[model samples]
Target: MKKPGRLLGSVSAAAFAILASSPALASGTLAGSTITNTVTVNYQVGSVAQTATSASNSFKVDRKVNVTVAETGSATTQVSPGQTAAVTTFTVTNLSNAALDFALVAAQQSGGTAAHSGTDNFDVTNVKIYVDTNNNGSYDPGTDLEVSYLDEVAADASKTVFVVADIPLSLSTGSVAGVTLTATGREGGTAGSQGAALVETTGADSANTVDTVFADGAGSSDSARDAAYSAKDDYTVLAAALTIVKSSKVISDPLNGTTNPKAIPGATIEYCISVANAAGGAGASNVAISDPLPVTVTYDSGYGIFLNGTVTSGVCNADGAAGGSYSSGTVSGTLSSVAAGATKTMRFRAVIN
Candidate 1:
């Protein structure tokens, strides 16, 4: 017959190995789940079989509350002045052991450093929050469902969120607007409706009751173990800054030929208008320049208006395609486009009255 001590030791080792091979649940043991442990002892006394004895204990699993908030992209979101429905994306994940609700907020920063290297200089208008309706990872203005808070988010799952806003008009290029998306952990286990704010259990743990414990780390605008987290994002403006300048010079007169000519009667005068776009600014299109001729000069119909000319050293060149109109005492021309860090000129020659 086998020794009792050796047989019991072999059985215990086999039981431990079986327990270790069991797979772990995604969210661990569910909260409010009753976990019971029982031990049974059987032995033979004085060569006779004895009855088995058993002991048992049970406790309820506690809830572990946790969450994470992160900006979806690495670079600053590029935007335009007066743009509507500009979007910034973020992800909110539930790390808790039970389902939970989260309240969302889009907060603007004032006069400080922004995410991805920039300074906050302005605020966006009509800021709102929306949840991704189709998991497409892109913001859909009318298709996405707008909500003030997330409801019944499953544990270990994530939800994509959008911060939609309108950009103010006349914002300069490189202007930045910093924003933070905050998600506060709230009560869960409900469906359709938003639950109340989550509260941590402060007293001792009760074996029969499930207690909540916060386990979230610090975020952009929140502290650790606060049941809330935040992530930062910013919008940078991209626009064109255009400037126009006009200059006049006497080309010839009745007494001079391509020499030191003066603005006298019957003298040929050349006019130049330059349009320059600032560097690092957006390209301008369909640029139109209109100049009304002064009473002292007459239209030089012999030399028609020169459109889409070139400028060098702050001087407009006369080499341009002849494509402009002179009517109603005004000179008008329309340019196709003026690229950034580039200049276009319009030139014409007239005679002094």
Candidate 2:
């Protein structure tokens, strides 16, 4: 569904709160009111604008900007990673008068670590920011990493940062991310010209925001972030957990004679791994299960089944060990969600030779 972009129509005084014992910071103390304005969302095709760019003239109001980072079919076309998806966009717009100067020191869009070229838009050369991985949003040196400045956003002009988040790579997504950006302005030497805003972002969407944009479609995500956070914020939140889980190991029969549950020769063993969302955090997708076929059976050359030529439910029974580079039977199963404490099991059997 294609919908018209929103102007963010309203602003709350609470959105900003600025104070100045010294009257040299900004337009106003930013203490009482708020400013909300229009911003053109740079989505691919089906993308929807969550809110208009909001800010404040009073330094006391402590202006804020909320943005949502997501994948679009293309920066030029669709909003989400449609059946066939392509581009990635990071949108930001300044609601203030003078042009906005976003100091980008370090940043990446799709992978684990970004290849920030010597290029202009992608390179976050040399600035610093306080990252609140804990979600406190406040900079805590003990808990946060002093990440360098990343890509910048234009003043009042909503802009998008493009990247490739798709899979299959010799080079990693570096660090998959819904990069949350922050810092006060610094293009100028004036007092509050580089002022800070109370910024918020949408959670990182799996593909697009349509399903995640509304409350009706959140499913497990509703509970994970399950908050009013935006796409960018969600990405930051889940990114932490995803980082931890990505480090988990997949089981495989080691050729080494060392461990317990030693590979038995000529014996069939049913392997069942039930993935449970042990903690109520987030769910993982595109999980690949791998294990070395037991040494007991040999894999059939033609069919890649067990040497004994027996097959069961998602299982291969034969002389325990399989042939031809450790055979694998299937990669089909959908665990819609492994909710907190909920488990999804994948079973594969190996026969002993």
Candidate 3:
């Protein structure tokens, strides 16, 4: 009743106040009925005994930047053709008055082989980054994460997410870097709203997101061979055709469905993909097998498998892109190029819905 008195939503309101004040129009982020990154509001209501009403919305965004690979950093060290180094920067700008709800935290590899290896030193950790949630260039309600706490980053102020991804030194040698990554976050404590509802609703523009990437290029320090790029430059490469040999492909492995059948919740069937190479295939590159994790899963790096990718209810992002079935798990790992045609077998276990 009474239009629920006006919803409160802001993505980065504090940034606006801290950066520089905009007058005249009382405008920009504060002027709009909704703003992303920051959150704050003031309302005037008719006196008298009336019902107390409230409203909330969220935001989301998907952005990325690709960088080039380097050979080495130290002068004593030689630049090798196989080894690589690079960094990416993702900026989250708050336009709201109230502090940005979340902070910049972990980095997730949405669909790539480069992940959080213990060797990472410049990795941006212990922070919560926010997304537009809806990629609408604006932040609102429902599309945010509320797990971590973050005050306003202040309007006009920006937060940077640093990522130092390294390439493997093997036959595959990295014709490319890593896969796409998406920074996720919800409204932060600074929003001062009622908070997110786990079961009530999942709104767009409500969640936080930062998805912009910048990649560079560099020459191998020890190019005991020929020289490629003199300096680091950004480039995009298609997925390399890794050597793979099929050992098993069971669409309906009733036995696996019962025995190893995805232990993930609601998983009805399981697809086990395993492979072996004479060179152990790849060395220690991150191998990301995308399919569907229904309940919750774990990427057992030791076994190169996901132990808990369950059969959950979350909707898939792209169709036919992430692959609906793990009939034959793809390898984005590290190892020899497989003798240009070395034979290797892989087993992908999928849980049938």
Top-scoring candidate (lDDT): 1
For each candidate, what is the lDDT?
0.86, 0.32, 0.31
lDDT of 3 at 96: 33
On TM-score, the candidate that comes out on top is 1
Backbone collision tally, model 1 = 0
Q: Sort all candidates by TM-score, best to worst.
A: 1, 2, 3
* Steric collisions counted per model: 0, 79, 114
| lDDT tens digits by residue: candidate 3, 1-353 | 01122354333456456545645221133311332333344445675545554444443322211122222221111122233333333444443332333322333322333322211212222223233334454323355332332344443444433333343333232233322222222333334542231121223322344322222123222131111112221212212334332222223334555455433444433233222233422332333434434444322232233321211132111111122223233333222223322332222343433
Candidate 2 per-residue lDDT, tens place, 1-353, comes to: 22212443333333333322335532222212333323333434458545544322211123232222232222122111111122233333333333334443223344333222211122111223333346443334456444332233433444433332232222112222333332233332233344343233355422122221211112211222221121231111121022211111223344532333445553334444445444534445554445454444544333342221222452333332242234364322333344443444544445446
TM-score of each: 0.83, 0.26, 0.24
Report the candidate with higher TM-score, 1 versus 3.
1
Q: Weakest 10 consecutive residues, lDDT, candidate 1?
A: 1-10
**244-319 in candidate 1: lDDT tens per residue?**
9989999999888678988889999999999999999888889988899999899899988887889878888778
- Could you list the CA RMSD of all candidates, in the order they appear? 5.5, 23.4, 27.1
